[model samples]
Target: MGRGPSIEGRKNAADAQKAKKFTKFIREITIAARVGGGDPIANPRLRLAIDKALTANMTKDTIERALKRGTGEGATEQVVEIRYEGYGPGGVAVMVDCMTDNPTRTVADVRAAFSRNGGNLGTSGSVAFQFTKTGEIIFDIRETPALEEKIMEVALEAGADDVLSEDGFIDVLTSPDSYLGVKAAFEKAGLAPIDSDVVMRPATRAALDGEAAAQMNKLIARLEELDDVQDVHHNADLPA
Candidate 1:
């Protein structure tokens, strides 16, 4: 019954979200360059981070600045990467990856998010065994026998582990080590992926509905809203 958000308010929210995304991208780029080298050609991690930044429409100059900060050519903040494993509503396994300057604050905030959302924080390795790290590339194309065959041929030849067609999308799964190579092969073959990433895939999913599902969604949203949280992975299968 009340008035909805005005256009300016919506625009402001969108702009803020974009800024947050860019900040996260820059942080990832800086860390990758710092861990590896500034040269994308030589540093696979940095190369992937650069690709993501470009795909997100990030400016080259901004990326260069982040690289400089990483390589010590410019001032940089000291941030630590941490992983937190937990369980959300309906006993769904959850994993969170974060980069933060304050570990104490980050942990406290994460724990609170879980507690407030009918979940609880877990010790390291508690929920990690439920997942496997793998690379996944998804193409937003209508499923067809011929198209599936072509995609499978290309992906397999590129060293992908498997190709699957379902729900009008094509999936190319690969080992972590072969992810970059497979992605490059797809690009050369003019197959652009709508989404691709190396992620922690859950082996099993917990089905939730009604109140539990709502709580799980809130838990995820809360974790994502934390400034230091980077990635959130879960094994909750909720109704659409």
Candidate 2:
């Protein structure tokens, strides 16, 4: 009894999503360069950001402009990183990371999203203690099972904290300080990851279903739609 999108509608939606992703990628590249300097050789974060942007088909000219902006050349507004903590539907702890030129507007927008979604914003550190920051490298498992053992051995030998295989991928967890080294080791072993990033992992998860699950999904989607929001993390386990 649900209406589906027409072919044209689907194409339009796909285009919009791609545009949104490109915008976010640009923001990330700018921030990383700003914080760590414009030279990717000296800045691992910026290097990672640039790699992702390139993978997304961002033009070289666009990437150079973003780097210039970060280094205060041809810069207009100053952007700052901010983190907002809150609880979403079903009491799920949520954290929103944003890069914005205006903190007041960003906070107001985030608060509005939370309040409208049956949630309330929390004070700093209210929920941050329940999370840990770590480096995560994910590899697609397209080869034989023997590949898993090799990945685990190389990752751990190179300072990885843990290696987990699931959902057709292998995840290598490492301390933030050891991330680069572990990644290099994987590459040396001819095991390139499909994705790699530093992220905050939740210590616990909240199980939600039915109306609560639907509401949580809506809340996350709305938050992501905001231009300034870069990443949204939560400790909710919704039914697949």
Candidate 3:
């Protein structure tokens, strides 16, 4: 008989997963701080970046060093945030978010990926019009309804478009201009959400067949392997 699902094995697997995720956390923090500033107190984005680092178990020294680079205390490079729009296989529209010190090299790599992966690199704003910017916040269920109630009221008061109650979480959507106010409202209510960021939501979606989904996923994976690539959003919907 073969041994199945050993406990020690599962623990080791979890640890490895955590370590890999921690590396990505540090990278993002470093990049975020480098572009913005090290002081999280004054930089809301840096504060969010630090929160992510803490959640991923990044060490204090690592976080500090990243901050130092941001403030010019350490050897640093200018990392500009850029977004690429493309059409992936099956004519699926995709957008790639990147932070890079070298735009020339990054664009060349991104264009190549699109060409080799059965897609074409699109002109700026080509796919942008297909999406709308929204301030989306993902938070856990608080212990009491007071926090939830306050969040909804404050978000709506601040011009949020909608408030949703998912299975075990709450999502608040706001106009891009009202995002900061809504986020501040959540903080004022003492709810530290897991993540909050600006994202692109599609105006209309184009469905992909199973084969197209697989191809698109492969293309997306290839984009993720690039060091500069941060986030990839696509109109293709994947099965849950």
**Which candidate has the highest TM-score of all?**
1
Clash pairs, candidate 1, are none
Superposed on all Cα atoms, the candidates' RMSDs to the truth, in angstroms, are 1.8, 2.8, 4.4
Our model 3 lands, by Cα RMSD against the true structure, at 4.4
Candidate 2 Cα outliers beyond 4 Å, as residue runs: 1-8, 139-144, 166-169, 184-195
Clashing pairs in 3: none
Model 2 TM: 0.86
Candidate 1 C-alpha lDDT tens digits along 1-240: 899999999999999999999999888999988999899988977987888889889999999999999898999899878999999998899999999999999999999999999999999999999999989999877744456666788899999998878888898999977888999898998888889998898898899999999999999999999999989999999899
lDDT on C-alpha atoms for all candidate structures: 0.91, 0.88, 0.79
Candidate 2 per-residue lDDT over residues 1-240, each given as its tens digit: 998999999999999988988888888888887789999888988887887788789899988988887878857467889999999987899999998989999999999999988788999888888889989999888666668888999998998999988977899999976787898898898887888877888888999999989889989988999999999989999999
Q: What's the lDDT for residue 115 in model 2?
A: 91
Q: Ten residues in a row with the worst lDDT in model 1? A: 141-150
Residue 66's C-alpha lDDT in candidate 1? 96
10 residues in a row with least lDDT, candidate 3:
19-28
Residue 132 alpha-carbon offset, candidate 1, angstroms:
1.9
lDDT of 3: 0.79
